[model samples]
Target: AEAGRFFCTAGRGLEPFLAREGLTLGRVRRVFSPKVDCVSGKVFFRAAARPGELRKLRSGERLFLLLKKHSPLPVSRNRGKMLQEIKSLVIEEPKYWLDIISVWRKLHGHEGETDDVSQENALALKRKSEEETNTTSKRQKTEQVRAVVSEECQVEAGETCVAPERTSNQECWIESKTSSEFPPKGSGETPSANEKLGFSFRVSCRCSGAIAKILTSQEIGRAIGITLVKQCGWRADLRDPDLEIFVHLNDIQSVVGIPLFRLPLANREYIKTAGLRSTVAWAMASLAEISAGSLVLDPMCGLGTILLEAAKEWPEACYWGSDISDLQLEGADGNIRTAGLMDKIELLKSSVKALPLPSESFDTVISDIPFGKKFKTTNDAQLLPDALQEMERVLRVGGTLVLLLSQELRRCVDGLTKCAGGDAAEASADSDSGAAPAQASSVDGNSSSLAQGGGESVLSRRFGSLVPEGVYAVSLGKTDAFIHKYRKVSAPGQK
Candidate 1:
């Protein structure tokens, strides 16, 4: 099989997230508008216009093109309307060119007309008319051109027209012309073309909810030229698609598309839960950025959601997940096997504080830190702190740690970090001003609290009691606590 393009979709307002990781906007190929499903109260991907001048593109180059062509409209009713309008344009104007000399002769006696004009004038007029026809016909092939014009815009049937290649400078004017005037006057439109076009591409994010939205949004899939052939339960993996589109829906919208072969997260079994949230996927992919070839450890793996996502995101790395509950591990194992990723992951049973792995082996650690009333621990207070110490011991000197917890558990993490010889600090120091901490209700039936205050206060309060300052001395530990701090790193000697 040929190697496919590597496509990475982003969430709304996440272009900056990709940019910070050294990815540029120019690498994207298309961005769909967002649509809301009235029945589900959920948003989905809508089809979008494909960027022009992509005929020569290699499969790998399309993702950047998608990002560069992102929609400018706000992802709301306004965006839905815009999608409708663009689709209408494509359906109404489907334009095509045909050699029209014979048709012109049939319509208006070609020999007599040529004889009447001077030889030079005949040639000039022919050239001029052909130029006009070429311009008009070229528009028919464009998405916008097809949207607006209906009648077959062809040269007289027997006439031949050749299109001259234009420079990049000339392309802008041509695109503008096609977008504005491809369909000149009256033309019937097709309903299929007008149906809101949706496009999506597979992204690095491994969240299930985000994946579901992409699979269900026909508009988004069609825009990127991907067809969802099947939807069995929450996960559908299509093999014979031109591209795989991923739609990320929030209050905001982001759509991405890439050719089928470049789909990094193709295995559905890797998605542990059908109801995984988009935020969690974003967090997993972001955390994958911290280490190279480092083993990831998740003590409270639950259904192995984080481990599965991490394994896909970092294929070069190994993953180990353990849980106290055998039922959750069984589900996780099934998911891993279903995804065909069992080779990359190892699952075991272990308590939070007493993991089977050796110390100083893991380079990065991440977990969803269980909470809520459903999960009862004999000593809830001691559980979190002890887990933190184990993580510290297992993680290498220059390693990284990421934990997802409720606001109340923040104090535990802080106290543990301090006890582990690192300063207690919030990871949001670099967050945009006035940004609220991301909030998600507990899946295990616990009340949720917003993560406010700085890292110190949040952690202190969550874990109960303030951790002593200077308990752990900061040595070579540089805390990369910012959410967007996961920068891609080259292997030790590679350029």
Candidate 2:
């Protein structure tokens, strides 16, 4: 029979990821099992069969497979025998002379006969035995020749040799074979040398069990011709480090060196700052082209986390953060100081409804508004509308606004914006007293109305024609858990 095919399955939520990684539907012939997460109700794909052509797989190959529902379940039973078989096939069978002899004995028969018949039979048996022995020897020789040819082909093609080592352990066999051909010792060489040259050294440790420790800086420095001096030591920056090495220490054996380009994570210091949750910063940064020297404004700046991250990411930016609470401002100031970014940021205590800066003062506005019953607010329904208007007022024409709003507030904001002139036309016009009145009909061909009687006549007149159009409703739970970005567009003539 032909050799069995290799099967692989995708991790949960990794089907699209696998496709992106170039895994086509046709490549996966069979799937054997699923990895089900009982708690999360998530399912992962798994391969049904061990790959016979293991050398073909890349380090991060995305494989697909189908599983037979009633396929033999994996168990401890016959495990030893199966492992022994694989070992014999991959490593011990350089020549199959002994196996050939065993087959020959099985083909012949044991019997008794009279003296005359016995003599005749003995002669026949002798001839038969010689023929069988010669045939078997030739077959063995042929296999040996093929094995050598295959080895050469693998080396020339840069294919891995997957011969087993220490019959009982699978991981040990793979590591032994890999190390024999491409040892980690001279991994510091340039890519060209690595591809062309051959090294004699091999990894001594077994590749079994959990990875314990990582390689020390001293070991890595030694490999790369750098001396590690603890006293006059260099403090390496992980972000742009030249080399990273991992040292794994086994309970029973000495430490081993693993060279890598990326370093292991040391801690979550960046993620755990006072007001600047890493997730929130990441969300805000994704909304716009935040570059060095850009202007960033956070109106409802609690703890200044967004500003801190913006300063770090866009070091050339003028970061402005403001909060209504003095206590929050104090905390934000302390955080900014601790980050060593005081020079890069400007902090102020101000109301979101009435920012101290002039109109169109910032290139981008990003904020996470307060929410829930526990959150304190000046006015329940008016809070979001007022903050959004302020955000529109401060952001430059065409600048982006990324907001984190509660489901209830998001609905209210959307309602007001949809009903209020669709774009920032009126808002922009109000910023300049020289601008003309809004057109009687909006871009959407809807008739506009001028409502009167609010204390803030400027805002009332600006949004009066649009607020009656429709109620904007946003369902927080229904909305995808992601940052929402909106661009500010000038109304006609206001541009």
What is the per-residue lDDT of model 1 for residues 1-495, given as tens digits with 9 covering 90 to 100?
A: 211123333333333333333222233533322221211111222323232222112111113222212232233344344344322211211111011222222222244553322332234334334544686643333323222211222211111111112222322111110010012222354425322231111222111233233332333322222111111001112321112333333323343322222321222434655423323434544644445677877778878777766676567888888899988888888888877887989989998888888867877777766654345543444466567667666765556666655444543344333322223233333222123332333445444343333453444233222222211111111211223111111222222
Assess each prediction's global lDDT (C-alpha) against the native: 0.39, 0.41
lDDT, candidate 1, at 213:
36
| Candidate 1 wrong stretches, greater than 4 Å | 1-9, 12-293, 371-382, 411-495
Candidate with the greatest lDDT versus the true structure: 2
Q: How big is the positional error of residue 68 in model 1, measured in Å on the Cα after superposition?
A: 11
Error of 1 at 461 (Å): 16
Instruction: Report the lDDT of model 2 for residue 314.
Output: 62
TM-score of each: 0.42, 0.39
